[model samples]
Target: MRHATTSDGVRIAYQIEGQGPPLVLLSGQANDHHWWDGVRNDFHSAHSTLTLDYRGTGESDKPDQPYSTAGFAQDVIAVLDELGIDRADIYGTSMGGRVAQHLAARYPDRVGALVLGCTSPGGTHGIERDNEVRKSLAQPQPAARQALLELMYTPAWLATHQGPYNTLGDPDMPAYAKRRHLAASNQHDAWDILPDIAAPTLVLHGTDDRFNPAANAPLLAQRIPFASMHLIPGARHAYFEEFRAIASPLALDFLATARQR
Candidate 1:
């Protein structure tokens, strides 16, 4: 992994894989680069992948302060700039999708394409999670993590695969950092600004996602000019992890199409 310093003097950790056109992968709240472990390598076969740990997670700095999606967008650019890459396609999940929205909107030259999964546009129009999910996700406790798994995965999938869920006994990020990440995530708002995003966009979501409802997909596709939406039947927030084969290929096709345009 390599390091890049943000304008605020915070260090960001990033890793690269494969050998082709650049593709940057952004993680959701409280997750590090490990979030992409499921499908990153598959995409890496055709594209060079860049994965990063957002400021408060993974191997990056965790400040005992507030966070914003806007600030995360800057850290993304710092990574690209450090690597000497002019532009790249972006894949953002959950909270990271908010950052991707900002990247395509505010730093148009830096982002050529975007893929948003299990995320919202924020504000009143977007679909927000219910109270149960909110309370469970407020802190990364063991019970909360189990509840999260239930919310993030369908029963059938869980029955077939419990390895990932069983291994998730401890919180990956510290309790303080988890709270800070969640705080920043809850404040994410790109409602009015989503339309300003000019990059080609693809919105992937799960039909049964309790964390971020699937209804948000149509709203994002409707708002973003060059956007398409796909919903995975009976899947949840961690749709990519569950439907890696389909979702990954679909994402690659979306990005490949963007490059030709």
Candidate 2:
């Protein structure tokens, strides 16, 4: 593990492994780098994968202050700069996808290819998750955890596999930090800047994604110029893990093809 000091003096914790072109894997809301542990190895053969804990999670320092997706992008930039990575393929899921939109739009030269999974474009243009889902999330303790598990995976997948899934996010994060993380992701609005992205892009989502909703996938793909969209059949919000056999290879191929172009 290594640390990158952000402009605001927050220490961002990151890890890099494997070989080939650099690929940054950004996790969802309140999650640390461990969110990608299940699928990180799947891309190692094709790309050097980097994962980081956002300011509020994992080993990163969490200050009592506001957070923004733009700020989160800066955290990523600081890490890349610390590692001397000029450009990389980006794979961001949920809240991380929101951060990737800002990164790709604001730092086009720093991105080679982009992959956004189970995320929204945000603002009024974006589709919000239903009230029922929100209510389930608001529930206390074990109930909320169970709701999250059900939301992240399909019934068939859950029935077939027993998992600790890493869906609970950072258990050690302070409530304030978690709230800050939520606020940062909630405030993300990149619709006006989507066209600014210069990288070849792939927007991925599970057809059955209840957390972010699959309807947002095509919207993101359509807004980003030359971006393509893929929906994994029967998977949920954690499609990258639930369907890595399809998602990982497709992203690697897209990144490889983009590099050759």
Candidate 3:
């Protein structure tokens, strides 16, 4: 039930868990703070975890305007500021990674460490989802979930995360909000800003990611002077959630002791 208002007057909803160094969790497009439900607890035991619903999703107010990556970053800063946090580790997934990049780049002093998972740097250098994946995404929830699982998790891990066994968030974003989110995601470009990031960063990717493609991982590591890359074999885009047993610990270790520039 916690909330913070952006400088633009938009109210953003957020959740807090754990108790140590602050670690903010930024989810990908079309989802809310609940999106992190599957994996956020992994960091709760070691760090104070903060998960916020974007202005257009979950319990947050959704304005009918174009959403931008920079805007999302600013929202992050607002949350930190409201909580009286000076600096903390930030972890983002997919489109959230794009926002995290801009957050670290634009507000360097506010981020101590960064983790980018299953994301792209955007611009002309980034890869796009193939037509087939795009088609699957447009299907009804039943079929769409099935299609998404194929790209999100390894075949063997699928059963544990799909159907009645699923534990993901039921993001309440409206159609308009979804479109705004997609528009922002489409326009996200962190290529130029990446080199300016001063916080130590970890670029984590799944080898089987079809949404953003694993090839973009090295590009992120190479672009940010203080970034390193990790590619998990037999994993896919939703590794952080589906494979938290592995991915979450790696993230904790990196943000736990990863040297900051």
Every model: Cα RMSD to truth: 2.1, 0.9, 1.9
Candidates 2 and 3, the one with greater lDDT: 2
Write one digit per residue (lDDT tens) for candidate 2, span 1-261.
Answer: 999998878899999999999999999999999899888998988889999999989999989899999999999999999999999899999999999999999999999899999999999999999999999989998899889999998888889979768766888999999999999988989999999998899999999998998999999999999799999998899999888899989888888898899
Residue 50 lDDT, candidate 1, scale 0-100: 95
RMSD of 3: 1.9
- Judged by lDDT, which candidate is best? 2
Q: Rate the local accuracy (lDDT) of all candidates.
A: 0.85, 0.92, 0.86
Backbone clashes in each candidate structure, one number apiece? 0, 0, 0
lDDT of 2 at 124: 94
What digit string (tens of lDDT, one per residue) describes model 3 on residues 164-203? 3222333456888888998999999889888999899999
* Candidate 1 structure lDDT: 0.85
**Which 10 consecutive positions of candidate 1 have the poorest summed lDDT?**
162-171
> Of the pair 1 and 3, which is ahead by lDDT?
3
